[model samples]
Target: MESAIRITRETEFYQGYIRFKMAVTNESPYAVNEVTLDFVYDDELLRVDRYEPLYVEKKGKLHLGSIDGGKSKSIAVYFDPQMCSKGTDIECNVAYKDYKGKRYIVQMEPKEISVICPIFRTVSDINTGRLKEILERLPHSESCVFEVLSSFDMFKLVNLSREVIEKRNVKHVRTLYTKDKTNYELWYYGKTKVNDDNIVIKLSFLAVQHTVELFAATQTAEALTGLLADVGKDLKVTIESRVTGKGRFNLHLINSKITGNTINNLLDQCNMDGTCDVNIVIDNINERTNAGRSSVNNTNFLNEQEEQRLEAEKQALIKIEQEKQESLQKEKAEKELLRKREEERLRKQREELGRIQAAEEPKRKEEEYARLKKEKERQEQLQKEKAEKELLRQREEEWLKKQKEKLEQIKTAEEAKIKQNEAQARLRMEQEMQERLQKEKAKQELLHKREKEKAEKQLKNKNASTCQKINSNNSKSNNKMLMFVVVFGILVLIVFFAIIPAASSSEQKAIDESVKGDNYYNQGNYDSALQAYDNAIELDVDNSTYYHSKGTALCGLGRYDESLDSYNKALDLDENYTAAWTGKGYALNELSRYDEALVAFDKAIEINSMDAQAWSGKSEALFKLGKYEEAQAAAEDALDVRSFG
Candidate 1:
């Protein structure tokens, strides 16, 4: 089947998790259905922790419902990197059904993944032959090759190589291979294999001073080459033959043909006790053997050649030792000469320094004496100037004193004049205040008398009206009794027809005015509502409902004090009026009288437990009093009552 889906994926290691992002696109002309993705990886290397769609597990499968043609969907998978080894591979497979309901599967290529670990590049640029020679003499059984150079310390070289190996991920073990005061050896294992061979490079000191060796054992030349290639050119080595003084020795076995056994034999020959130098002469005696020579003569010639080689080696050793002694003597003489020259140079420098100091001493002392004499003259001049300044200062002080006394006199006269003027003003103000107080008292008395007379007159008129009403009612009752005796049915009809409708009409008119006031109050027109409520109260002075409504309107006008008075009046008319009590509480809360407000609210609540306004007013009072917990409880109660209603 032609590919219907195109998938691209990328992997990243972040915050200890290996996160994979995959972009899956439906490339076919038809929509894909039942789309799903499956991931697979080495369990030893990677562990799947989580995936998008939330429920994906190590089974590595994700179910994508569907994808429309030309549309794309993104999938993400996360795994723990710590669970995986380095250089593991992760694989992904995508399976989906096409529009025809035919199943199709796509296998994604496996991606190679690796974790970062410590690494150290190998070093080269070293003399391989001499290095091999030293490694052969070391107390080691493993087959190894080496490079030796004369300029580096063997111990330092070994330490540096160990440091590099320890930095890598390979498990390394170091052991004492050999122990000597001058010559030392160390063995290390758990070396990383190069070219499929377990090999380890090592360094150690040689018997010859200032000479070190670098060596490694490998099963194949290819392995050695691979190791050497990684070693690169960083480890610089310079080789010089002690006997020949020739350089450029290739350490490769194939090129040099000098095996480890050969090097060991050479070291044995050099190490013979009391022997200065011993050279082993290896010749191809077969090529030298001739048909004319006898076996005995050939043996004699070989022995002679060996004797000659031994003599030459002895002479070379003597020459070397003699030259070494001469060089040491020459160095000693040069050092003594240099020391004497340094002492002579220092002595001259010291004498010159003393001469310069001695010449400058008198000149310095004379300059010091001149400086002191000039300073003494300057001090005397400064003293004379100070004396002149003191006399001028005394004169200025006297003039200032005279000016201060004259100014004080002038100030005293001005202060006395100000006092006189202030006293006159005070006397005039007191007289005016007394006269005004008397006028105000008279005016208040007159107004009080007039008000009292007016109130008495109104009371008298009210009493007269009440008496007339009582008389009229009594006369009517007497007439009804008389008429009833004469015409009982007609009298009863007249009493009901005349008196009941008139009283109902008056009460209805008052109710209508109160209704109007309630409408104005509801519309937020406090002024109009107040006027309407006043008319209603005037029509029926004893109506507690009108008084309460008036208080509500006054509160709406922000006239809390006036509203309080109205509420008090309503309470007077009907002591159990809950609305008036709640209104009074609200007014007191607005006026910041929180303690009194709470009392009023409590009274209202006592009257009607289910009253939302009473509860709400109580909450406000409690909040003003800084009783937050009680306020919140009261607020909740108010909300409960309102919700129920």
Candidate 2:
């Protein structure tokens, strides 16, 4: 036979109820007989009293009255978990006995049990008699006696609870002892019952400490006896208190006296024992009421009175602070109300202003149009006057050109006349040359004779080699001076033409490219316009306006990434440029980088809040990021700018 056990939580922790189930399967060879199922668990922290049983087939059939081998039956168990906290796990075991008197333990998988603490009170029927009052005072001391003796600090008593004792695992229970006071040991007791359906479980606990001098006197002992008898009628308190002597001191209720004179009689009875009996009840009352009264002095009393006054003053200060806070809150609320009213009034004024502006816009535009028409006519007139001035200047240039041509012709004619005069002079000089040549021919004949004679003399008297060397040296010096002048002239010309022109042309190209790109961009041929703008930037990378224009063109082309890059370039060139920041935000929004777009928009707004495009772009980005609230507010902010669409 197969049997299964199931543990389930019935009620929550506060209700203290838990339930279980048992099931048996039938597949055995023998005939079925009676079987019993028992559910067991750890009843330490919590105890269960009753459980319902299983009812199988009727009339003692094959599977009735008991479970045979290979036969199945089901049973249940119910309990309470009154002390269990949430998520506590409890385990249960089940065993069954068949009709053949063979016991079989059920093998089943373990199940996890959870207990939820409910809001209801745990104990239903609490016996609040004399014993109950003593049990309620089980955990008595506010602070640990040992820790207080060691540290002498009262701070430990503040915010102390059961958690502190449990954390420290403090085993010693707290109780007060007095040397001069009478001994009346106050003990508390509690009891718990489990698995008893006949009676509800009630726990009565009494705490008794073992000490040498407890109830040392007969009168005190008698007082303890009378107190215990009046506490419970059927209370069975476990007494662990120590006896003063070796023998166990047992009190018989029938022999005990109950009158106040019984203490006096017990003292007299103990007179031969050399100990005077004292009333413990009176001692306990006095001890509790006059705890520190014996140590009071005049100085201490005055200090205490002053301390009380200071404490009262402190309390007054706290109350004043609380009142101040309340008043501040009230004033803040009032200020906020006034501010909101002012804002509403201002908003209405702004709305009125917007309406007025809207109503005046067309009239203003019409007047502007008339003014523009007049301005255009005036510009046309100015252009005509400029054209006439240009024509007059051109005519003056023609006259100057005619005069320059006439002067060139006259100068050429004078050059011809000078050439003619040079030819006539040359002819005359030839005639004189012929005459002089004829005379020189005669002189040469004479010179030739003198030279022959002088040569013959020089051949005998002079050194010819030295004179030829001096002539060669003079001719080389003249040739070197002429080459130096020619090289210096060529170097000057090369510097002017190559190095100077290269630098000047680079600068001129940069300026010209920027100007041309701006012209093309302003004309709105964005394709060629962007090309020109890129060319301008290539010539001068630091040109912010060129980058701005390129970014604008890229945005127009729907190339948001490139546009963002270009705008970033512009910002790098000029950090304070509002146009670049606004453009960058727009590009980021186009790419759906809403967070970055908002940051860029904020920067642009900081630079200039009147940037309508930035406002609108920020509104759109905020809307897509699940910030519909902010989006609506931002959209309203955008409409506040006149240029926002």
Candidate 3:
């Protein structure tokens, strides 16, 4: 059968709880709506306590809203494994509804681990779906019988269960009667034996829990005496080899050889002190010795004859029981037929009476319906008017409230802009004042140099008389003065040509490029802004502001990886730049590196506690990391910062 929806489950174990992850996929061509999953499991074994996500869990039902065709959705449910029933296996069913409100159910196989006896498992640990493989292997070798008696009807028994009906095997099957009521003892025995000497596996249903019993015929038990011990009339053997790993034991007999996985399964079903006796049967232990070979052969031949007689008697009993059930069923069918005929006669009588009454009451019924309809229409009109008035009033109130909030936000933003503009104006005034002072100092130095040149030219024109006289009078003092003047002039020329011009051209041009990038960014031209910022960086590679602006432009282009590089460069230049820190956090979040994003956001907040962008980015990171409450708090902080900071 094709399913309308497909469900898969995975389980995870934690310190004190269990996590069950369930995914529901829609397989149909049309969408499924109102897809709610109602969990059904043994309440004694597990309780659906809470969720790993999808905050709402009510009475074990989860509302998944809607699923589009070919789409899948998943949820994780937490469980507390505490048992009230000792030998119960943990299984679950999910009931869900389709678009038309029709319900369907799906069953999940039991887990390998139990609540109280977690280390142990039975044939029940095998997924019910895989039981067919084990059963199909039984026919060629029905000489070995396997029976699993589980109270769960979920085993899908019709896949192939055959009755042995042999007197020898049926006698060993568990009794059908227990307590006051009858408990089903699902029994099956082997058919034609291919090789009676070899072992075979079997599965038949029986009780609330599952157990597998294996049987085989041995001609001479002496050959396999070392395999088991006979204590009294009961066979008792204890085999315990430690399984190396965790998880369910693999007991499916794909090969004839028994491995550690198979032994581990048997060990799980063993009783306290580690003894497993319920599974094995050896038929002819006493007849294996040669001393009693003739006597045992006579006894076995007679026993076979007697077994034939008993099998005939059991078949007779089954035939008698089938005849009894058929007789009862025939009687029941006659009674049902008679009752249904009587009901049909009564229904015809009622219909005849109804027709007669309807023919006589048409006018009165029509008048009453017309009057009722008029009254209903009047009431509906009044309701419509009242509803319209209420809706209008609500809309007016909501509109006024929204307008007030919008105006407040606008006012705050305008105030912030005004303060920024005022700061820029003060900065411009300072720059102009410094430029004027530099110009005044340069003008005085130029005038001093020209006057020195004029004085030297006039002295040269004195026909070398004054020059020779001064040189003759004070040659040593004159040389010292001349040397000092020449040195001072060279120093002034170097300052004018080297330091001031470099500051005015290279560094100033870089600042101009950075400002242009900011303008382009404000205009939402991210490509142009990025180009301008790159030009600025080429001119002044050490400036933090250029890198910060470049990061913003890269973010605008949705290039988060490169944006992260830019933000990191900015941070390396100025570790205390709050905007760079915030931008780095935002880029990290876009890259889905949430933990590192939180650190960046925290650092930004530490530098400037009122950074709304930092708070908002922190909120998003926390939400992605599954810290819902912390995310909510950070979101509220961001809102408050934006509204009033």
Candidate 4:
């Protein structure tokens, strides 16, 4: 039956498995049904593991169901590299039925499958003669070999070997060390299952050298070789032993008689140690002896043959001499007759040539003269065109010169205009700066006047309050006349006679200076307030109020440490000074001495429990100390006291 299907097969090697993909297209007019594909490969070299659509073990077949006309179907088969022997081919057979239930089977030509062991790929990459020799010596049918560079360490080589094996799906890898511990062995299965065939790889390290040797009993030598080569490339080292047969001589039998002794001598010359099969053509001893006798007799028979050969040569020379004499007589007769005929023909041709030349001479001269006249007119026209071109060139040069001059003048004008604009801009900027400065100066003067008036008003209020307190004290003294009249009369006589004038003079002046400092402090003039407070303290050094006022001015100036010292002095004069204690806490807080600040705040609270500022300062110190709970309580206390006030 005629075939109506086209099939294409492809094979690829990935890790240890060979993948076969077949694309089948139906070219018939009717749809094909029950399409099944069968893959046949050498069982010893390859074993089918799985396939697409449907996979049947042992049979290596896949059922593709059906395919429509002009449609295609693909099937893939994955198989393990069993032996990986060279020169092996894999066959594919496709069987299917058409819509009429007519069965047809197509057997495609066997495709040559190359199971390139990774090791062989690596050997190819190195392309070294030494490596190729080593690869040829390796048993390609059942074994593989690998050698690490002289610079590689054995420990790293072993680790890299395991990685290479694992990547190829080899499992249960275990290392074994030799008795001397100088050599190691790795045993693993070709597949993930333990029951599968195992590959035994022996590794040995060369002493006093940097090279490592690896030997394995497996069919996937190519895979191992490629892995080692890749590692060598990554390490920038060279692999010394890669087995290849590229340059080696491969013996083949030809149609020639070779004796056993000759074969032995040839083998000896090659120094071959391996077993080799030599095909020999057996012959009978009697037949060989008769042929030798026949060769000797034929030599004598050749002498007789030479005499007959000389006799034939003599006869041929005699015949050639007779023919030469006859040819010379015929040639002389023919030459005499041809010479007479040639002379007659030449005489007639010469007379005809003279007549033709005499007639054409005048016509030739007339054509020559006309040609010369046209040449003179052409030269004259060219001279006229050259003169006009020269005149046009001169005019163009003059026009360009005028254009250049105008462009230069315009450029100069633009540059001058830019300079004038820049000068005007600079002058306007200077005027604006002057105006801003004048406005700032006026604002400062107005601020100074307002501050002075505010300070004066505060000072007047302070003086009035002081006068009221003094009057209150005098009224109290008057009210206590009945109860301490005798004591008061005695004290009044002592103050009037011994202390009244001196106390009034020095203490009154100190109070006035203290008031002046208070005014300055209220006006936000801490530097002047500090100086005025210093004067008051000089006049009355024992006055705790004077020191307290000075500490306030110091705190306003951000001199927390100096402020603390002044507050301390105030406390020394009067330990119960609440304002001084609170100011000292604020100064300590500013100095980042949170613990000392808390203690000062506690003291102020003890002296005057209603002091809200002291409570707030204590809360701030607590917050700084990371005591969130205590800080919250203190803050609440501050709010309560503030609300009460």
Candidate 5:
């Protein structure tokens, strides 16, 4: 029921190795079949080699298995310090499980682990057999979890199940999985172990890209190494390893060229569009049965793409069908118009016959008696027929007029539709062009910025190199000038002493003391220099130079308290001594007395406003006191002064 693993012996070796020891006591009635240890370290430099007796799978994974409860086991593994970049620390964790499938941490220990320092000169400078030796002698601890992931890659720790009667016969472990931004998925089975009470398994998956943390809940290195190898065959990189400890001390190195990035990218590629199912199983040694849990889902990228493609195809089909419909409607409208015109012609002929018949019928009736009566009746019949024909003609004419109107409306509608389609197409084209141009402009701007940065870095390096050369030359010139001055002074002193009355002994002694102090200070003998300066000040307390010299020496000796007092004395003697104020500020700042340091720097700035050092000191003091904005302002002020000066 306890959360953390207990440490029997957790220590780091000097040879860049870690050793962990733990007691696997089985408190339950069920026997512990197996124990697994998972070791993790930060191996950035890849200083560990393949042939160093370290067990690493081809995919940069290691697995160690077979630890029993009520039994104590020790694991030792080496880490290559050369593989670690400067400032990176190494750490590890241990996991324990019982045969009855109950899981818990080892009873006694701290979770936090410290990294051991390596022999820097041998690996960084010498570099010969260094990796092998270091790997063999790595110090490890069972107290905490050691996580040794190299880069962000797609990997999964899977617990494989062998179907058995009992549900408790499942392994416990954690696997890493990763997918790239593009969403591609990969699957790999690492390694697994079945022991008396506990089962440890490792599985590698090639989907979901992320930086995963290694925890104690993970299985042994042996299982993980095998799983990585399975995944590595299809991937650009893989991790393989051999297990040591209850999977605690992983003396395993990676045999993988697959960078974390490559794995992640592949995962992204896989997940970009599809359904993926990742299954994990837990097994218990006592029951010989394992239970499995599966997670399956469709990637959002896939669903989105499918939806987009479907929408696009649907729109295209609709557009094509609409065009066909419009064509059919146009042809039908033309046929209706032609039929209307033919009907109109027939109607005109019918109206003419009706007029002729009516006129003839009235004349025939007056001419003949019996013959006239018969002829008149026939004429009346003809007139009736003509009237009927005239009515049909008018109906035909009305139908023709309606058909003409419909034809005109169709023509207008077709033209308007065509115009609207053209306008929309034109707008889409213009928008696309604008977007392309904007993208091009952005790319150009990015290129320009990168070029500017490169040019600036080059210029800075050139200036730094030039300044170093100039400084070297100046030092040589100064030495030559000093030699010449010393020689000339000796000659002048001999002539003056011989020609004039000798100076008083006190004046001579004072001058001698000042000369000695200057010599000692120049030679970096700060204590001696300070003593000599004290003597000089005793002889002439008003001498500001003596106080300044003493303050400079005290500062060099790390006597900031004494140095601040001396600088203040020098300032009292000469209020305009800018150098003394600078020294005092520096000393006070060293003592973390920022307020006083600020005041001293401010005074120096007032005396000589263009002094960059005084302004810089003020900035530093402000920064230390958590006044970042003020610090920035002060720094800017110093830069302005330096730039202008």
Candidate 6:
């Protein structure tokens, strides 16, 4: 049944958008009902679009209604991409029901699609370590977010970033307090060229630290989604993910990307926290776009002097924090030592007390042994309870991990489904286009055949009925018709081939010399070409083409004066010889005779208006004369004539 339905997909690109056309056709004996195509789309990269002959039933799905046997329907849909992306799959499901009430879904093979963006490069994942190392060493303030920078001064770009932040609605802020606190800026930039479907871009992003407080707030998951939701509020974000054994902190930023569940991989390894959360896609501030520290200005949009002042302040603060951390470590170590000493002292006292009891109550030895056994059981029970709590915590962490994996799987599935409907629509449209073309071709052929038959009938007006013809004369007419066919074939062969003429021996020699000169000229052997053309001129001095050939050969040899003489001689033989006139113009131009060149070129143009060489020569002559406007017009004429030809 699937074989009974045929589909084809066609893709086209325009200046601002891409189009996918689909054609769905039924080759079955019976009609199908309620045919539908469904798929998912990433809103961030492409926006949903509609053109003529295409109507959507709903988002991510198209209701095709019904497909009759031997019928085809087509539609075109468009995509306007906002950012570059690594390739993602969008699966399509084609489901339909037969008149008999049986439903079927057509499965299609996966297909590869290509997209081209001028300046942006698409990457699957980012390596944050390298990006962070580069950013931390920036000489400027952290608030100087760069949007696009190679074309402008650094401060100006930073000013623009600051302006965006000021005008922007801060919307919401959510921070995760992690044990690790070394946060680095991330970005991408480019100077690139994408050829065909192959995209190549190079550039890094620049951003400020104003967006994050680093480790200040203890934001619950409820307060977190506001920013993530805005990321692709109008459209769905496309994600490129990988499976790793190194996953930690459900939402911690480990990979260059920060898609997290427990910690949603948003921050780097040092930013790890013991928790779970969803994810968001953040990139470098880049050509078009990135600060924050403790007790620091939220907006580090400072001037050079201010930046220096801030840096000095930051260094002082950093030193103080380091000393504070060292003191805390020392205090912790001393406390651990003191606790161990106290435990040893308590153990000694217990032993002494136990010995004293043994001597004082020798009869109570059985009671003492039972009491010791009970104490051992109590300690063992406490250990068992501690182990169970540890195991439970491990299970909870595992559960969070499983949930994150499930979400990723769901996203992957949805991605495939979205593209499925889009591809399906494209296939249906292609089928319709092909059918229209075929019908048009057949119609034209039939019209041609009918016209040909009409002409034949009009020419042969003496209509003799076969029944009225004598049977005895049929053999004679057949013999006559056969003879006519043979005669006609011979005439056709002669007519088609009669252009071949037998030249006299001297004329043939002249042509051979001219051909030899042409081959030499093509090979850039101007000295040899000149000799051959001279021989041809001696053999057939009256031929204008030979003189023109001699002129070109002389021109090639830097003999402009001689070339001019030869051109004049060719023109003398035939005044309307356009090539000789053009050659004369070229020779005159080379000699800096702009007036003479213009006259010669004009003469050539008068004889043949479509002569591009003459137009080009005229343009050069006018340009030499400083008639800029006239030269431009002549140049334009040459281009127009060549394009038509």
Query: Which candidate tops TM-score?
Result: 3
lDDT of 5 by residue, 330-411 (tens): 7546644764584466456545654664576466445446676888999999999999999999997886555445333432
Scanning candidate 6 in windows of ten residues, the lowest lDDT window is 234-243
Model 4 bad stretches (over 4 Å): 1-505
Write one digit per residue (lDDT tens) for candidate 6, span 1-645: 235577776665532245666777888888988888764444544564565475558765788888898897776766544334434333355777766545666644433344432332333322444333423432211011112211323332333222222222221111222223222222232212232111111111222321221110102221121112222111111110111233211111111112222122244333222122333333222211203323422323354686676456445544654685577567656755775596577557656865775576655666778988999999999999999999999997886565445333432432233224323543464455457656755765675576557545643532333335556777668756855765575576455334322233466677678777867876889999899989999988898878888898888888999999999999999999988898899889889999999999999999999877778778778867878678768877876765776
Per-residue lDDT value at 249 in model 4: 17
lDDT of 4 by residue, 167-276 (tens): 34443322334334444444333421322322333333433444344344333434533333233222221112111243221111111111211111111221123222
Best of the two (2, 5) by lDDT:
5
lDDT of 2 by residue, 1-645 (tens): 343322233332111134455455655666444443333333432344344453443332112254455556554444443223333334333344444334444434444454432111123222213322332333211100011111111111211211111121112111222233222222212221221111111111111321111110111222222222212111111111211233333322221112322122122322232233343111121122355677423221124665566456445544654685577567656765775696578667756865786788688778888999999999999999999999999997896565445434433443344334433543564466457656755765675576557556645433543355555677768656755765575576546446644654554565556556555654656777688777877776777867877887787678899998899988998998877787788788779899999999899889988765566667677766867667656666655663342
Task: Give the per-residue lDDT of model 1 (tens digit) for 355-448.
Answer: 7756886886788789889999999999999999998998878865654453344334322332343335434644564576567557656755
Task: Give the local distance difference test score of model 3.
Answer: 0.54
Which stretches in model 2 have alpha-carbon errors above 4 Å? 1-490, 493-501, 510-524, 542-544, 572-576, 607-613, 623-645
lDDT of 1 at 329: 62
Return model 4's CA RMSD, one decimal.
36.9
For candidate 3, the TM-score is 0.33
Tens digits of lDDT, candidate 3, 566-595: 999999999999888988897898899999
Model 2 lDDT vs. the true structure? 0.46
Better of 2 and 4 by lDDT: 4
For candidate 1, give the lDDT: 0.58
State the displacement of the C-alpha of residue 51, model 1, in Å, after optimal TM-score superposition: 83
Error of 3 at 473 (Å): 8.5
Q: How well does candidate 6 match the true structure in TM-score terms?
A: 0.23
Considering lDDT, where higher is better, how would the candidates rank from best to worst? 1, 4, 3, 6, 5, 2
